[model samples]
Structure formats: C-alpha cells, structure tokens
Target: MNTTDALEAFALTWTGDLTYDVAPSLSCHEVDTLATLLRALGYTAAADAWITKHSRNDDEGDAHYVTPAAALREQLADASDRTPWVELREEEPDAFAAGHMVLHAGGRNRFAITEQCDRPSDDPDRT
Candidate 1:
C-alpha cells in the first residue's frame, strides 16, 4: 500500500486517548496496525524491532502476552529525533489545538494518527 493508504489504515484503527487525564496510550491492536504498516512500507526490520520491544508477559508465557505501546505513543506524538528511523509531519488542527502526525519511513508514508493532545485544554502544556 502507498503512504496515503497506510495512513488511512492507521487512522481507521486508531484507539485515540485511553486515559482522560494522564498521557495518551495506544492499544495493542493499534500498535500492531502500525507494525503492519511498517512492513508494508518496506520497514520490516523496524517493524520487527518495534514488536519485539513492546511485547511482554508476566508469567513469560503466551497466555498473558501483551504489547504496551504507551511510552512510544508520546515519543511518536512528539516526533522525537531520538529514533532516526521515522520522520514526522505534524499538522496542528485548524480549530482546536488538537493535532495529527504523519510518520514517514523507508521512503513511505507509513503511519498517521490524531495526536493525544489534539484538543484545546486548560493544561498549559496542552494548549
């Protein structure tokens, strides 16, 4: 799929903000969608790295397997240069202070989603 298509896919499955007050988090399914998009964009290595980094288990068994994509949700939203793999295009919303991010990697527009802060709020950091 092309960059636009990948972005659309990401948006469609986006979980948005799960916590109202705390930092936003993405669901496992949302993270997996991004991983799949990475592979589709020819970033198989990056995709694998992401999945491996996120996967975890309490009993070290498959029964309770989980991939918490929370930490990087902020990282991606902030578009930190700490990870050199993805480039981000941040679009501030026209009305509300809410924004969206489009991630580019492996010469493809692979991921896009409405940011966790995509809104006007009383929080000084958010506005």
Candidate 2:
C-alpha cells in the first residue's frame, strides 16, 4: 500500500477506539486550544480540559501537572482507555524519547504517541 494509504488505515484502527477519559497527544499550542475548546463547551478551568496540559507555574518553577476538571476527569480517564497516551511508552521501550530530562530544556515532552508501526518498506523485492 502507498505510505499515505497505510497511515490512513492504521490511524483508522485507533480512531475507532475512542475511549473517553483518555487525553490526546497535543502540541503546546494544542494544549492551549483544548482549554479554549473546553471553555466553549462549558467545561471549567483551563486545568479542566487540558489533557496534556502542563506548566511550571510553581513558585519554585519545578511544578508540572495537568489537572483536568473534576467533571472532565472521568471523561479524560475514559479517553485514556480509548486512545491511551500512556500505552505507547509501555509498548515502545526502545523508542527514542530524545534528551535525558523528563521534559526537554523547553519543558515540552510528547504526552502521547500512537502505536508504532514498521517503517514503510522501500525495497520492492523484500515485502
């Protein structure tokens, strides 16, 4: 299959697994956007809907956490069951996380990644 086709199919496999409480693998901007969306949806707190939402707001500058609102926590947990951001790490122990710190110098680390797949085969004779 073509690379795009394969990727689409693989994505379809998980898109159908929409578990509620799970958090999405969001970028920094996306975390912000989710807060905005949740706000629009009547979910309270930027902390409420920010799944991968995190920051160093602590006075010591060492604090980091994502506090989905109490109402949304169950939904987020359901989402975790569906898409499960944490599952990628469990399945991919050797996957390159880049840098040694939990969060890079910029304080950003991917909160989720979809299940890994074999590299697209380029050798016509091999597959």
Best by TM-score: 1
Worst window of 10 by summed lDDT in candidate 1: 15-24
Candidate 2 local lDDT, 1-127, one digit each (tens): 9976664564444233331233344444545655565455444443343443333221223223423232234443445555633222222234444321111112234343232224444544331
State residue 117's C-alpha deviation in candidate 2, in Å: 41
Candidate 2, backbone clash total:
16
| Residue lDDT tens for model 1, 31-99 | 577668767766665555454444432223532244333334545744546558877566434422435
User: How does candidate 2 fare on TM-score?
Assistant: 0.23
Residue runs of model 2 more than 4 Å from their true location after superposition: 1-24, 45-127
Kindly report which residue stretches of model 1 are placed more than 4 angstroms away from their true locations once superposed.
Answer: 1-25, 57-127
lDDT of every predicted structure (CA atoms): 0.50, 0.38
